[model samples]
Target: MRFTSCCGGAGAKTLVLVGKAGNGKSATGNTIIGRRVFESKRSLAGVTSTCQLETATLSNGQIINVIDTPGLFDSSVEPRLLATEIAQCIKMAKDGIHGVLLVLSIGNRFSEEEASAFASLCQIFGHEIADYMIVVFAHGDLLEDNQCLEDFWGPNCPQLLTDIMAMCGKRAVVFDNMTKDEDKISRQRKELLSLVEAVVKNNGGKSYVNYLFEALNMSEMDLIDQTSEVTCSEKSHEGKKFHIKYEEQFEQLIKMVELRLGECIMRLEKQLAEERVARLEVELKAQAAQTKSKEEMIEMKERLERAEELSKKLEEKFKNAENQSKEKASETIWSRMGCIIM
Candidate 1:
């Protein structure tokens, strides 16, 4: 995340400057970059109509990439166009942005149009940007005697501006971009980079990523995803350990359910077995009753045959007696007739 290429092999810092038009935005860029790369002329139409980016090594031997946006916060340009321009600026900082310098003119009145840029920046980048942000009071040469950065911006400053700076961790700096004093400019740029380095250090050497920046460019999202995966991996490892700790308890629960189910099945089988035994006893009783009935039927049949034979014998005796009586009656009739003839 450091650039050692510029300024004869010094480490780098990527900076993006944002503010209203004619607020010395380009001049501030030239100061940090240590060159006249950006167009810094005053005009009714304003200088730098579109976004321009340049990189240079500062007098501190630190390479800084500056993206100067034109009318990004000014009311002259359309909001849609400004949005496009801002996106282009972010695209140039794909290496990762360490600082978002909110450039405000030292003495000018902050207009409603410029005041609205704070909200727009949030929409474009994300809320996290304001965390490590630094407020640059551009045109710092206008400061009167006994009037410092905070006293001027704090006492009568617009409540909106105060709140915007508060979002930047209450950090601010002054830049005399017009000053030709080589020593003063050098000191200012050095302090500015030092403040930026503190922010990076507090953030653990990582740049602030706007969640919305992901949709603006794929690389930001990939960076977030990679970081998230690493974070998730650490948490997942902890989760795996927790799972292992409870594995024995989980097995015990399963075994308890299985044992209970086995007991239920055994009870059902015993009930079925009892029913089968009762059924068999009933069948055996029925077979015994049937056998007794058959035996009684055979005995009754034999008794009936005996009764018929007894009745035939009785009938023969009665017929023999009747025949003897009839013979006697015939003899008496013959004797009576013979006596009458004599």
Candidate 2:
């Protein structure tokens, strides 16, 4: 891939623009640089197929380096190509990245692809990327005069968008790329730069550099050295030689990413299964306890009925014995009276 760098000096804050197709990432980059450095147009497929870097001085004379990247989740592009482009983007920002702009079109409905954008980025770049991320909503002109950026975050707002914003520390800004008013453009640029500055400050005045890339750079150098040794040793065929391109290295990186993603998915599935099993066990235990309670209640009722029947029988027998005793006493009294009379 062709890499371009121009007009960048020391302490230039580097910002990378990433998003899906037709989300105005290029336009956002252009807006940030206060110029049309990156191409911006409407397309069904995509305009940017690789990474491009351009630098511009802000109104305050602060040099800003903007890297415009191809669509991170463009369906039309192959996985290998996307991986290579992303690798190029990382290489361009290998020194350090001040902030990452996650551009989204405010007018477009947030779809599943867009919803998973941040998670996908995390899967590739690690979760720490969130610390340096700022969500930039493009096409702010679509908002009504009375509506603000918060208006889009009503009850009906997408939960994924809310999650992404929270993940990025709730740092976000809306840009009207179509706006030609110099005051509005300058204000938007200032707001974005302010967010970027905040990101730098929150990170202890340091830019983000992935350790994985550092490891990859070391591995690449080692590979190149090994290849050189082998080529020098091979005197049989000088014409047929082995060479390693960055594309190949990136392909390997992509494979590693795929493998890691697979492992995460498997682990998640296992956790979900375990949770289901635990929930089912709880339900079964509750049902068993309820059944035992009902059985104990029934036994207690039967025992009470039996005790009542026995008490009734005993009371009847006592009444009969009393009546017999009374009758026998009355007869004896009458006989004695008759004897006295005779």
Winning model by TM-score: 2
lDDT of each: 0.70, 0.78
RMSD of 2: 9.1
Clashes of 2: 0
Q: Model 1 over residues 124-230: C-alpha lDDT tens digits?
A: 45567776689898878788765787766667888878788778887888998878998988888888888888877766676655432333345444444544555
Residues 137-157, candidate 2: write the lDDT tens digits: 999999998688787667887
Worst 10 contiguous positions by lDDT, candidate 1: 1-10
Question: What TM-score would every model get versus the actual structure?
Answer: 0.57, 0.65
lDDT of 1 at 26: 87
Compared to the true structure, candidate 2 yields what TM-score? 0.65
* Backbone clash count, each prediction separately: 2, 0
